[model samples]
Structure formats: structure tokens, C-alpha cells
Target: MKARTALLVLIVALLGYLAFFNFSTLAQDVPMSLGFTEVHGPLGLVMLALYALMAAIFLAYVIAMQATWLLEVRAHNKALQAQRELAEKAEISRFTELRGALDDKQTQWEKRVMERLDALENHLKARAEESDNVHAAYLGQLEEQLRNQPGKESPPALGQQ
Candidate 1:
């Protein structure tokens, strides 16, 4: 059992014992006064009744405080759960934003790479065309020279007269 419960039981038992011990005296009639009137009652019993009334009020106050504390704790837990949910949503949004940004960057990088590759292909094609033109011109010039020197006899082979 809880310490508070134990202490409350002990106090109640002590009060009961005291009241029982004074029961004989409490049976004797005495005079009591209120502001508006006077009454006759057993003095010990009146005092015991008053003590019981005060104990009841004190117990009620304690119960009220405990109920208030429980309500506050419940409210606090609800607020904490809300905050956690909010944080989770925020984190998910952040991740989504980051993912979108990465995708955009990846797309841009791919576009740039494709454009560079196209430019390189065009440049290489142009270079190949220029090389072919130069080769064709050189062959044409050699054929013309051969036609002009036909009457002078073709040049001998390297090992022949």
C-alpha cells in the first residue's frame, strides 16, 4: 500500500481510539453556545464531531488537489503528444523538400552532361569532315602533277632504269 494511504489509515485509527476512550465522558451533557443561541450537548462528543467534520473537509481538499493534479498531467501528456506529431510532420516535410531538391539537381546535371556530349559529337564530326576534305585535295593535286609529266617519261622505280 502507498505511504499516504498507510498514514491516513493510522491517523483515522488513532482518532477512533481517542474517541472511543472518551466515550464515557462524551456521554455527559454540557452547554454549548452559538452566536445566536445556546444548546446542550455532550462536550466530548461535540468536540469529536467537530474533529470528524474537520477531517472530512481535509480529506475532501486532498482529494480535490489529487484530481486537479491528474487533470493537469493529462493535459500535459496531450500537449506533448501533439508536439511530437507536429515534429514528425515537419521532419517528413523537410525530407520531402530535400528529396525534390536532389531530384532537380540530378535532372540538371543529366541535362548538362547530355548537352556537353552533343557538342563534343558535333565537334568531332566537323573535324573528321575537314580531314577528309584535305586528303581529297592533296590526292587531286598529285593526279594533276602526274598528267603534266607524262611526256617527260614517268619517273623510274627506285631500283629500275
Candidate 2:
């Protein structure tokens, strides 16, 4: 279906056709020398088998490398996730600390305001008491003067004409 797959299939077909056409030559026995003995086998078929074995080995190597790469990528992603979690935790801790400081500052400000209000109330109370004392002394002096006047029998009532 895909272009690369089609190309591979075409190449295999061509090779197969060539092999089939040369079947008799491929089947012809040839002498092969081992270290201690001589053997006979089809040379073309042996060569084809060796090529297939090498191709299989190469494919295995590629699969092993791909597996290794996948493992490394997974490890890297895990490390990155861990770092992100640590950063988030640190940020939350910083936020909590800042919030606590702000709350403490607010409490102190409220306490100061309350103290100032109490001081003002006490000052006002003291001034009112002093005014009351001065008024009472002035009234006492007026009463004594009225009693000492020789012609006055008694002081007139406040509402009398």
C-alpha cells in the first residue's frame, strides 16, 4: 500500500524471478573446503542463505537500539515530571509563607488602631472631669456671696421675675 513497501515487494519479486530462472545452476553441487574435510553443496543457495542470516542480524540490531532509545526517553520524561512536581510544591510553600506574613501584618495593624482609639477615649474622659470640677467650684463661690449680702433675705428662685 505504501510506496516503500511497494518498492520492497518489487525488488523481492525480481530477485525471486532471477533465482527461479537460474534454478539449475543454483542446484548444481560444488565442492566446499572445511578445515579438516571437504563438503559438497549448492553454492548459490548457500550464498542466499548467508545473505538472509546477515539481514536478520541487522534487523535484530536495529530493534535492540530502538528499545534502548525508548527506555531513555521514558526515563527523561519521568525526571522532568518529578522536577515539575518539586517546583509546584516549592511555589505552594512560598505562597503559604507569604499569606501567613500578610495575616500577621493585618493583625498588628488592627491592634495598633484599637490602642489609638482607647488612648483617645481616655483623654476625652479626663478633660470632661476637669471641666465638671471647675464648674462646681464656681457655683460654690456664687452661693457664698449670696449668703454674705446684708440686704438680701434669701436668694430669688431661678425662674422668679
Give the per-residue lDDT of model 2 (tens digit) for 7-80.
Answer: 97797788789889998998899998887999999988988788778878977998999999999999999999
TM-score of 2: 0.62
Candidate 1: stretches off by over 4 Å: 1-8, 35-37, 125-161
Candidate 2, position 82, lDDT: 100
TM-score of each: 0.66, 0.62
RMSD of each: 5.5, 5.2
Best by TM-score: 1
**Model 1: pairs clashing at backbone N, Cα or C within 3 Å:** none
Task: Give the Cα error of residue 83 in candidate 2, in Å.
Answer: 2.1
Tens-place lDDT digits, model 1, residues 1-161:
99988998998899889778878888799888987999998988878888889988998999999999999999999999999999999999999999999999999999999999999999999999999999887876775676568567655543355
Question: Model 2: how far is 70 from its true place, Å?
Answer: 1.5
In angstroms, the error of model 1 at 32 is 3.0
Off by over 4 Å in 2: 1-25, 32-38, 124-161
Least accurate 10 contiguous residues by lDDT in model 2: 152-161
